[model samples]
Target: MTDPARSTVDLFAPDVAAEPYPVYRELRDAGPVVYLEKLGAYALTRYVDVRSALRDWETFGSAEGTAFNPAMNQNVQGVILTAEPPEHGALRSALLERLRLSSVRELAAWIQESADAMVVPLVDKGEFDVVTELARPFPAKIVGELIGLPPELTERFVLGSDAVFAAMGPMNARTEQALGVIADVLTTIGGITAADLAPGSMGEALYRAAERGEIPPEHVVKLLWNYAGPAFDTTIHAISNLIWALARDPAQFDVLREDPDLVPNAVDEGLRYEPTIQIWGRFCRTDVSFDGVVLPGGSRVAVLFGAANRDERHYPEPDRFDVGRNARDHLAFGYGMHRCTGASLAHLEIASVVRALTTRVRGLELGETRRHLNHTVRGFERLEVRLS
Candidate 1:
């Protein structure tokens, strides 16, 4: 009905990506759908609008690709995040067979064991870099082993995963560099054979599915990329962010340490407070109206998860980080059918670290921290912490 509110916000700018909440709050306050002049896309910043868009896939479609740049969008075409309807469902089903809650729950013991192995020594040492020591290695090891990838390839996948998210933004020098990394990573993955994968691993299972005609033979590589890319990147940042949150407020850590039951609550709150994936792209298949704002057909939409998660209209004291808060409904994982398939495993991995930390570490002190700047995700590249 009315012209959509407009802003010249450059979300992918280094400064903005490092500290985006202020910009996010401004956008959320502007309107339900704010037209981003610089990005040439509409931003859905309110909790209600974002959730609705995610649920209504027909209108806010992912099929045309969800990346801001055309190159990245074209690259994601057949991947689960970009496929529509039947194809999307088929791919999701294959992924769910392994990622189902029941199957993920079975890995809880192994996850906790892995967490303990990683966290305990760091605690005993008094101080460590959370990113390098815990966050990066924990998921790289766990997910890599599960996927049957060689230990060396697992580390390389992390680089590719970061590059994938970085290249999701408008093409620029940063994106160009990321695209180069992605090309090399894809080339490496392309050379792998079934014999290279561990027997009974999820990667091997995908090959078997292709053999059975459950998924296309060619889809195997794309599927592996889909699984490997998001699997480690999101969880790595989440682990670091959660630890950063606790270190920032020792009182919350104490609260968590006292009631181990709140470990799940802490994970949800951490995701809600500092989501790993800050924003994701979508293409409007048709003119979509949110409240009074209209996004014309063919419009590019940026769903601001970070802003919506902290919408004051949705949560009391939205900016405060409370370990007791129940934020399971947060859009950090996205909503509806496209909700992250690895959510359960991510929860398990984050909770494992939280449980391990709360049980052994008495206090946390955050030291020097450097933010990891990517086009879509927010996290610390380096986080120093002292545990006592």
Candidate 2:
């Protein structure tokens, strides 16, 4: 019998947002769904509940926007994420056809190449801000170009990407500043053309889809948000922390250097242990029953993905960062219909970087790093790393 009114599980609470694991454990252990009056949202503390809500999109409508932002109604125009099926399926399919895993494999070498070129010089320097130098710029520029964005427009990509990702968080100074920048960025992408999309890339394909009426035209710009947004921020966050992860324990670094093939598993385990994207939101379209509690219609449900990844019920001693953890089914990339479309791409990108660092960079250690200030994302603002 736990009270939800004064519960520590409210993510909007400043302290909880900064550090939520203790609260997550409390909610998960006490019950399946915790009714939170303050967040005006329900908390899904268990893995099963989170999985079900993601799958049950019809019941958990994305049209109204997932977060508590009532303004998201006007703000979410044309983004495939806000559109329900037929339209959602069409837009998702069109974008998927472009960024499919098969397409990702085609760029694996390119990904490795990019990582090597960027990481080598930095590793040689022995120290650099992992966020500004590597994590932020590298992905912002590289992915922006690969997706058919021109070089001159890289600044828009960088600024907008920050805005959209930060917008995922609750209202705050960081989130406020980012929202204005993202609106402009989306407008720029929205103005681009299929011809300008740089033939055959995901961005170009999305415009083509819009023209073919495969997906809504408004959704095209959002595709940038959906595809590049997840791909860029999450990977950068993981890479930055990954250095933190391995460098924190030299034994682990030694293990990775000894065997390069473990890159994929190692990356997956890192995702599970310290996922960059901590929480994703969904809204109950109608009354939904789970854990013997009924989440009435219009309830805001905050799925504590960070908590689920560390759930001792699903994973043994989830706190430990064992590279061998069987995290295949982990919800780090989410689950069901909305599972991250860029999953393969992210893995390939991260794995390549991971392999390159272990093989090429001899010694690596953390110089300094700061957690990104945001309402949603939990990653580096600046990660200074020293490597030989």
Candidate 3:
């Protein structure tokens, strides 16, 4: 297909955020790359192109910032989210050291225990808002324990995280407001010490890295910010989306209930079907030709995970919410060097919840659902359901 010269899309528009699948289809049909004029960024809609750009971090760099807004993108430099390699390698290593598969596996019992504790009480309630009751509260608590932050402070962390995700999108009332809140969260984080977190928690590990000079002391607080936004927000939304999916299709829940081994697949499928972070940005480091189009140096490119995950070329019946779908290759946790550091932990958390639901609840009756209008994160803010 010939690349369309003009595909102006206000990605942050309420209508688009409310229902983006249609726009995703339009962009994919347009060509390999669609120029979003209002946001001044090229959007990659096809699965192949999106995956290619994510893996090719050298040409499509992160150092210039991944935020859609030029200012936010520039401002986010130096942090793990924006730093390119050698630097990214060092920073990523420090994080992965603590979050490696073996390390995260040790927490499986803790995660299952947490899920059981929260879900057991609610199973008999017959009706509850999954978002606020389970999805929202559960992740905040788990992240709090993982990061060793006080339970009271974890509540504030959720609000701060919402803002951090918002700041990644185009500059507007929402992004501006979130920037202000993030400033305060940063200040609060700057004051944290090892004593502030749980013993042997990720937060303490970060401090140990700083003390050993593996990471600069100044970046310690910034690293804590990572646990707040990306770790908490994405998993919470993924869990919410998963429950909603199962509830919508009771037979799917039965599929898992009959074979609990499918819990992990359910998590992967949920992420693919409705990714939490719908889109992420990358900066072009130098002139690069891709899919018959040259992306000039310094141009911004938006990688639409939502669109890519739904690409029919990659996934058959892309819109179907099937628990058995092997979606491990999905870009929901991203790809390449910058793939999500806490992916193992997220999988454990989501799977634990899925296991608890399938094993405990006889049926899930979904009620009114309300989606949050996040320009970047696509998920529900409210999902009412009853367990019987």
User: Number of the top candidate by TM-score?
Assistant: 1
- Which consecutive 10 residues in model 1 have the weakest lDDT in total? 287-296
As for candidate 1, its clashing pairs are none
Across 1-388, the per-residue lDDT of candidate 3 in tens digits comes to: 2443557778788888888898998888877777888888888888998888888888888887888886677657767888776778877887787788999998899889999999987887878999898998888888888889998778778888888789899888888888888888777887788888888888988898889987789888878886666777888899998998898899999999999998899899999999999989888778666667766677888899999999998899999999988988988999988899999989999999889888888879988999887768878889999787
Best-fitting candidate, scored by lDDT? 1
* Residue-level lDDT for 345 in candidate 1: 93
lDDT per residue as tens, model 2, 86-196: 777876776677468987788888888988888778777777887787777666655776788787676677666556667766666666787788777767876777777
TM-scores vs. true structure, each candidate = 0.98, 0.90, 0.96
lDDT of 3 at 168: 92
- Decreasing lDDT order of the candidates: 1, 3, 2
Tell me which residue pairs clash in candidate 2: 78-218, 169-376
Candidate RMSDs in Å, in order, are 1.0, 2.6, 1.6
Q: How many clashes in each candidate?
A: 0, 2, 0
- lDDT comparison, 1 vs 2, better candidate: 1
